[model samples]
Target chain A: MKTLRVPEATVTRLSIYSRFLERLDRNGITTVSSGEIAEGVGVSPAQVRKDLAYFGEFGTRGVGYNVKDLLKYTLKILGLDQEWALAIVGAGNLGFALCTYRGFNVRGFHIVGVFDNDPTRIGKRIGDLVVQPLTLFPEIAQKENIRIGVIAVPTSAAQEVADMMVKNGVEAVLNFAPVAINVPDEIEMRNVDLSVKLEILTFNLGFRNAQSL
Target chain B: MKTLRVPEATVTRLSIYSRFLERLDRNGITTVSSGEIAEGVGVSPAQVRKDLAYFGEFGTRGVGYNVKDLLKYTLKILGLDQEWALAIVGAGNLGFALCTYRGFNVRGFHIVGVFDNDPTRIGKRIGDLVVQPLTLFPEIAQKENIRIGVIAVPTSAAQEVADMMVKNGVEAVLNFAPVAINVPDEIEMRNVDLSVKLEILTFNLGFRNAQSL
Candidate 1:
């Protein structure tokens, strides 16, 4: 089991692997080799083994991996073994969507609170949580023991919101703002740039078009 | 120039290369060898060459590649050179956020229109475009020449929304819905799951914890 040295790319792929494994389990897959998992998730089996090996040898040399055990191991590696209380920073449409976002509650993560600077949105309810003022983030985060922060604010205000989250001792951040935020090396950030994916797809289409010509 | 079919993994890495090249260019880097680009992007120089070779002979035998030229070629290969019109379905939280989503507009892809089933939301304004009923999708999409469809609707309605987009003649789809979609092989689909990212981070953390013990 390696410590905190897992590459960010590896972490990202592990997330993909987790989803694929869940799909496998649902299909009643009782066991899987790294190669099978790789094919299913679109990765090299060696890469899969290397990623899993960062934690330990979950798969036997000749036999394969027990599906349920591997799932548990992946869950543990992702820090999803226990419930993580989440706080959404922006209470706008994206933030509101995230507050009730079905994704969080699915994998041992929960939105415990919502915060916004706007007074109109404050006291509004999304899901079971009521929106609170941004001024109360420090207090509420501490009270709820929130470890992760979701910043869905505008680009102009993203850095300010990120700084606030860092100062309040939040370690992991999921940023949806268009711009990238510079954080200390210790703070883990996974930026969900809705546009980057499209840009990549755009590039893909462009290449395909060029090849056709 | 040899067009060796590069792996999907390699194509994904091109974006990273493009980003690094931009950084190098910004730093006044005019020329770089394959080794340099590989080192900067944390890949093998041979890999860099191989990936670039897929599109065309981007590098000279002696000199590496012109930073700007290589970037432009990669961008073209990725299809970022052309503008894409986007039609979004479901004017809910995700839809509204995407309409105001700064990422898409900055990248040459524009959200020309947003459609929803809710009559109250129809005819309302979001950004520069007016919200229209989902019924108008075929008409508007045809009129606007929308080639890309973005389905930001909830999981329950995602399939129906996708079917409508397909019927409207959108060839590529970016689904933000939680469910897996079934589409014809000719149509390209990419799903963005925010929770999967968190799950990967959790998996890494879990693996580290196990190794330490």
Candidate 2:
């Protein structure tokens, strides 16, 4: 059997839609049209429909979708139905921020461990989890059944940390380091370049400036 | 004069290419083929060429691209050629991390002010700038000529912060808040959903599991 490939943009939109639906569910919004979802998330109605069509038939003609049902479907489709155990390397500000982030917990992501090599940072407490030494990652990861590893370290340490994660049985990695780091082909890896979004804004601003000139 | 609209993805790729080229130039590499760049950034060779084609012709047919020249061109096109004055609202962990994030300064984005409504956070220093009260935003933004505002607040405060920024003459916004935010049509706005990337990984992991089953 062959697996149908979904566009990453579609997957991203699904995540957004899931969050929006969750909000609607909380507000007792029982039904929603594609247009409402689009308006809420700032995408086109057709885009919302097209993205949904990739999975299966949803909603009734003109009657719209059941908010609770859609929310459950999107969550299940995105694999948010189950809690994921995660380990974070680099207990710097970014790591500390990620640990305390409310969004992750709302979406069922649990950070099981935070690790660092800096002697000063190690053993320090970040929220409820105490920062552990990098040497303890393998032990903590295995004990906690951690499948995801987050790289919040500096550029110099990113690659080494990724290697450690891979060696210690981390199935996926979310890298926050500015520089690119190589991981095995089979490992699910994504680079979150925080500055890239800022550059987009700057580009649009520059384009507008160029037009006026 | 009509301005050519470039795809956001192309602009994003250009940013990555520019960073990759910068790394190569720092190592004293002069010229590079599209394939080498594609490999470096994990994109296809054709994609590298297609994205660059939007700006204008670059590089010779057989000689490939001049690394330094391409880097300069990309930086100029992405509006990184000039320094951008920015103000960050919230002064929380995310804001502190952004204030100290090395990537922004490397790309010419300078955080001129950090603001929060909490009296306790105000006057606290992250780096060189001290956190100020929300009431001081307009004055600081005006005096500093801040064009971009960063929203690092909670969901409840995200929209309010956005309104404050727009009212204070912020031309663009980079929202780190999880929820969707509304900005004026002319204001260049983008949301950084950190959890979205994590969801993408989970979705892939789930899909792989389904494929094997």
lDDT of each: 0.80, 0.91
Task: State the weakest 10-residue window (summed lDDT) of model 2 chain B.
Answer: B1-10
lDDT tens readout by residue for model 2, B1-213: 127889888989989999999999999999999999999999899999989988889999999999999999899999999999998898888888998888766787988999999999999988898999999998999999999999999989999999989998999999998877888899999999999999999999999898999
Candidate 1 residues lying further than 4 Å off, grouped into runs, are A3-10, A23-65, B5-75, B203-213
Task: Give the range where candidate 1 chain B is weakest over 10 consecutive residues by summed lDDT.
Answer: B1-10
lDDT at residue B123 of model 1 (Cα atoms): 90
Q: Model 2 over residues A1-213: C-alpha lDDT tens digits?
A: 137999899999999999899889999999999999999998899999999999999999999999999999899889888989998899888998898888666676898999999999998998889999999988998899999999999999999999999998999999999878888888999999999999999999999999988
Each candidate's TM vs. the true structure?
Answer: 0.81, 0.96
DockQ of each: 0.45, 0.72
Error of 2 at B38 (Å): 0.5
Model 1, B17-124: lDDT tens per residue?
886787888999999999998877667988888777777667777987999999887766666677788999988887888888766675457788899888888998
RMSD of 2: 1.6
**CAPRI docking class of candidate 1:** acceptable
Stretches > 4 Å off in candidate 2: none
